[model samples]
Target chain A: MLRRVRYELAGRVAFPLLNALSSWQRQLKRRGRKPRANPFGPPLDCVRKLRELMTAHYYVGRYAQGAVPVAWVTSGFPIEPLRALGFHIVYPENHSALCSAQHAAIDLLQAAEQEGFSGDLCSYARIDLGSALTGITPVGRLPRPDLLACCTNICRTVSYWYKNLASHFDVPVVMVDTPFVYGEAEPHHLSYIEEQLGELIEVAERIAGRRIDPERLERTMRAAWEGLVLWGECLQAGKAVPAPWTAIDGFFHMAPIVTLRGSEQCNSYYRMLRDELSDRVTRGIGGIKEERHRLLWDNLPIWHKLRKLSTLFAERGFNFVVATYTNAWAEAADLIDPAKPLESSAKAYTYVILNRDLEHRLASLKQLAQEYRADGAVLHSNRSCKPYSIGQVDLRSRLAQDLELRVLLLEADHSDPRLYTDEQIDNRIQAFLESFS
Target chain B: MSTATAIGVDVGSTTFKAVICDGTGRILDHLIEPTRPQMEQQAREGIALLVERLGCDPALPISATGYGRKRIPSARQLTEITCHALGAFHLTGRPGLLVDMGGQDTKVVRFGSRGEVLDFAMNDKCAAGTGRFLEVILHRLCVPLTSVAELASKAERPVTVSSTCTVFAESEVVSLVAQGEPVEGIVFGLHRALASRVAALVAPLAVKEPLLMSGGVALNQAMVRALEHALGNRIAVLPRPQLVGALGAALAVRNSQ
Candidate 1:
């Protein structure tokens, strides 16, 4: 009888109710009743204030010296150092994302599709190409890039992206080489990076037509270190009974850390966020109103699957307490050391992208799960993200045997919808939840 | 009794499925369950349970499909597209177009006369048009999943689903509800929105007939109706929609052996 009701409800009441709820939430946002912080931790207002202060300061710094043409480059070589040396930083990822959010991505993506770029090429790439061709940002927000520095550590796409950007902008391009670390960074690799860093400094000095201010560079590095520590602390606070924030919130709040790493404002903002998270921990509030099972997520979410998966889990009384990728940003922030700013900054920057090694990724995930007291781990075997997809089976086996934690391998993609099936996925999730019981 | 028996398993994002078939593509028994912590273990257990239910021998050779196929420790791991094609061919007895909508993603596969995958288009990144997207919308609406089709049928005018992102889409749905839009119209609109998105993906492929719909989303009548309207043609849905991938895998295993 319950099954019959559920079956009926799926088609009739559920669909309409969902549409109504979605519309209502939008209205609430427009009315200035911002989403409350998950009662698990920290007030939303506090986090917002901190974020505003940090971003404002960072922007002021960027605009302070005649508007340094800085591009907030994605995960790669220490572009912050270059920005400090008086160059504009451009982040293609951010621009591409803006296009996506604005619904301009489809058109732009289709344009790129005509240029022989496979439909499988990173959506970000397609969006970027589209934006470049269209010469129009969704909301007229993205800044034109002046210089392109492609770092090879993340993937080959960075090089290709820079090549295109350099040609389009007719600017000088720099390529930073970091040998892939199979397991751990070696002294030789560190020395190689140091040499590249010195060269980068030389290039910046030439471009700015100014001498390097060692003290100012040191100061920036110090601020970056402080910011990282606070960020790490904020992430750790999620280990509290009700995590202070969700992964989605963390993603939204990561802008400062990524864009303004070497600024005092970033540190202050994180400090405020940390305090609120700490307060939440003290209050013992979980993100979910009623938490039943706490689970850890591995890899990026299958974007198309997130809603269905989130609902299914919620219905079954399962709450995702932590995710390794989300916490990784915090870990990267923690690596900054004010005392040894340059070395720490270099190391911290290197840790941003996750194309390094299986062991490194596994260790980070294991630590997060343990800290969060996760009952189970759901690994999304994403097809498009090869860097993330590899070594999952080994990781799953190890996590289960070593940590005695339950692990489920979910096959899906971060963006592609054709890769997964609903009924099969729900059944697997339901079974996994039942096993937990 | 059939001289040959084969097993097909689909390790989906959220579930593990097994289908045992006779030599002629007749299903003997099938099992579906939420994927457990260990996919390999869950798959093995699921297959065992199904075989036991059907009183079949435990030594049957198994072929796996879906995203988690490689992780199943099965003898053969085939792609979901391959499985969908085979399943469609078996169910419809002809090769045409295959549309499989799963939790997180959707696919439109073009099959040749021989049921080979000629070309396919997939949407996996965003949840906008997939089953997962519907589930989220359903939860926010406090409506049961089963009622979506009926509610949609009552919709006089289609409401627009403004946001493509599931998170934002939910907010959009909520505001619509607040505006006092009829639940039925909104439901119909959501299905239309999803169908439109799916249609965009299917538009690239050379859509042939008989258009066979597989995967979990095929059960959603509203979605099916919307898709049919979008394509301006009728689609054939299998009796057990979710088992298509597993059936495809079973057929592949039998052919290979």
Candidate 2:
């Protein structure tokens, strides 16, 4: 039928054209391919042009109307209720990182850094400021934020970040506070967060000037929870011999789950991704051609060293089967109770990122290693990120004693390339691997 | 008469270097190799090879330094800053400033009298100033490592590498090459550009000399020269440049014992 004809067209014509375009682009950038530009024509014009194209698609299309009232909520805020309320959401973390990769984040980041914010402050903050100043974001990217919200459960950075945004836009600001849950959220803590959730609903209703639909919110929460569960299931599928997908690919697809949490589209995407992964699992597909040793990666990657490290691991048959960050998302999903929506939403929001205790982080990593049947663990002692980098040495010792796991502490920065050395890192990895044999 | 020989390993990001030294801080043997998958084994093997080559005893006390030292179980670990200062001070016979540029990271160490570390600044998270970044660009250009200095010597104009990230800088270098800029010119620009980055680390410390440059990157004459030019002064390079970390570790072991 028509579907078959369309598929034929896509396979025969569209795919080839796309492939050719990609190859041509690659060729253009190859060494010795083109003449170098003058020292100062338009610094980062390519980045600007790309951002313009992306922004046009994101903000100017018919989908713009369909764009649900979206807000950028910081971690530690009760975004579940907003998701439940059917509002579109976006995480600035993902967007800032995209901006960083595009090289546009430097000017903006420098502005903040020069303002006496140490270079060690999160790059995301600098990138966000950069995007606001430059107006360059990916094509068809984030919808404009209609509200700015903050919570204190995660880190103090968000309050300042949101305050800056609110001042920029002259928009209303909503702040939520959730008492820290030492281990798990108690009933009182839940009640406190629940009260804030109620206030959020009131504030949101006032801003939108619309009647709040409780049933719709409940439905959204249920769907969002389902989507999160499915996403976790997809990650679990990577536990197979070859690891059906790499962490980089997982990060790419994590968008819909983070931004469109309550929607049918989010649910459908996860279901589809889950099914595709399941198929890969059945077919026994692996990420690496050679399966040597499986290792657990602790903390965030040294962004500057990801490729080198991945290549190093791949060449040696050491696949990073599991990570603590990826697993944290799913754990939050399990805690979301759609029936008692607001309280659960608050609880979920309060617990994310590296806000959890050191022991919790260690336990999660150990669980992933055990579940993935990993041979060893590589802990990147990230220099720029103190919050994520702390307690790794202790965790390494504990894992060695309890799990009897071999551990490697690799010092590097997640984004800053200045902190790592290939000769040093490579030598250490070689030594660690030979010990396993 | 016992030699009292000891082994010191400097496990860097891009290279695994080891040195064997007698009790008087005289280097007997040394080895430098690309860090492989089995780093500790590589260190052990490299040390063993150095010992065998030097006709030294196999059963020497060992100490480790640099980023990967904690993972190497054979020796007590010392920080790169401390070790670099010790090595520089030992080589120069004066305590002043030390600049160590390894594969992936850069550091500027300030030493007080008697080689005590006063304070230090490091550019460890960024790649713009490190030796690994130079290697990546050189590999992309299909140029031998030794030719980089020669290439820089021919540059008519310096091309600025604006990226703080090494990956992005590689693309920038590739684009420069594609633009048909002379390879030598580009190489010169790269060294100058990287020197500027290292200068940023050094400038903050306002370090006084006898300034010493150590680590693998110190072997790059062009970079060393460019760095000297950037700082508007002369810099000293250790005779056994790569052994600086290992030397410091050995010094630490000797002092501790």
Candidate 3:
């Protein structure tokens, strides 16, 4: 009972006050800088609010233990059910991504490597394990998980990554194994995932020490579904000739949907972003000063080099108007039916680009290219993401032949900067752009 | 008489080359030297020496290309890939494929009929299909760079050295040496390995006919023969192939003027 009191105090009073103070201080710092013109239109006004929302979330997490059930889950895991159970969810993958963006991942990666983890392992997994072992994180503190949930819809690595977390924390692990979908998912595959989701609820119910509520889950699913719909609308704004925003902006803006889905704030945030982007489109504003070439990006971003990479292309009047990675978040929104949450989630998660066959991926790439009116494509042959990078050679050739698009296969890792060669990539990009001349 | 009009300097990994070209794209003067560690110093001194030797005006626009193109304070900087394509297109006067195997990189470039680069592929951060691989292996095997082609030609049957990694291939070559394999056969085998690697990069492209070759490695007679055998096509070596990148740079600066 006392723990509940303390939790309310932290969530409602202390964290909100602290977050407000931090936001005010940041605004003061921002005011000192010269108000230079931004080619990508003015910066998003709600960004500081976003920082406040995320900071309060993490800050409140410190007091979540003993007050509510804590479940550490994958980014793609079915989290709506957990929300219905009143669990305080923590996404390690998202946190590791934050670490990667801040360039704090290499030290943590080295820490994991020293403890027998291979350097070739997924960087997110390494950063998380390294944080777990060292009790170090950019987030104030990660509440100890009462449950670990993992879904294989993203990749096979998450299952093992979560299992290790479960073993270390000595907690129960709930696995939602979505079979890889080739074309359309087999009915059996959906049933299998539905059954696993049912088991997941039981596990989450036990952890929460309460009964599962179907009506609450329905409400959560409705919000999640609406949130995704808004996100898809936001991304569709990129079809504007100059594009209302760049893909780098999209990469950062995706945080709310990834971390705060199934919440009112998450839905409202997307609505705001969508409206802003739509207004930009109507005003003839573009993401870059000049948009000479519209290219489509394939695979994950180089988190460590976003600034340098974005500037290089921006200066060349090249802007990546859309990306397959960011679109993955929105492409499956139509498949999510709130009426039958479990069955639809099973289907939607299974059909993600990573889980589908190369043919489906190629078709999706073609559709996106046509829809976005991309003149060329840059396919990153990422070293860390084999699931995403496999069969790209064939895809590159097909895109060129079928779409008559120029394609460049860039070899680099998304998270690890050590794998990138700046000089080589510079030469390749210059040559590619020169071809257009 | 054609006077020294424009200048180009190519600061490559293994060698530095400079060319002085007249307004008509005709070469009037040229210089070559082993590249020094301090690229800025070498590029400055090399450009001065070339201009002095050619009795050229110092006010001419100078363009630079290669790995250290930016190191040289020049009027224009272009990548070796573009420069090589430009030089090859001028040399052949026709649209075709170009294969330039340098010290550290191997490129397969396809240019349009008017000397514009259409498509290209380069070996990824590896020295297997490059001049450095042969240099290291030959130096280890007690064979001089000039003798590699002569000795490799004498071997009736070549031994196979299959590793694509430079370090591993060196070890494999050493193991073959320990087994009493003939040096000439081993050298020829190394050439074949490199040829096959370069061929794979070209296999995926719809290569234009009348394939052209350039760069320092193209001077190797055995490697050229191995490449022709692997490609199953006649290879035309550009005139003074080592000067191609420098010549391209000179042409670019002059055209810009």
Top-DockQ structure, candidate number: 3
lDDT of 2 by residue, A116-199 (tens): 567776667766755665555653345557788878765677778788878876777788876655687678877887787788
lDDT of 1 by residue, A1-437 (tens): 45445434543565456546765776677796666433232336565454344333333332322344444355555765675675645566655644543445667777777876777776666667766767656544444555567677666777776677677767677777777777667877767776777777777777666777777777777776676677777767767766656654564466566666777657777877777777766777555566677788887655544545666675555678788766665666666665665666556656654657877877877888888988788888876566777888778767876887767777765644545677556544543554353
Q: All candidates' lDDT scores?
A: 0.71, 0.71, 0.87
lDDT of 3 by residue, B1-257 (tens): 78777888888989999888999889888888888889888877877887787777877788899888888865488888778888888888888888888897888888878777877888997788899999999989999988988999999888999898999999999999999999999998899889999999877775656788999999988989999999998899898988999998898787777
Give the C-alpha lDDT of model 2. 0.71
**Per-prediction TM-score to the true structure, in the order listed:** 0.56, 0.58, 0.95
Name the better of 1 and 2 by DockQ. Answer: 2
List residue ranges in candidate 1 displaced over 4 A.
Answer: A1-43, A50-66, A97-104, A301-312, A332-341, A351-355, A415-431, B1-257
Residue B169 of model 1 has an lDDT of 88
In model 2, the runs with Cα more than 4 Å from the true position are: A1-68, A75-77, A84-86, A140-143, A351-353, A383-385, A416-431, B1-257
Model 2 residue B93 lDDT? Answer: 78
Native-to-model Cα distance after best TM-score fit, residue B194 in candidate 3, in Å: 2.4
Cα-based lDDT at residue B183, candidate 2? 82
Least accurate 10 contiguous residues by lDDT in model 1 chain B: B117-126
RMSD of candidate 2 to true structure, Å: 15.9
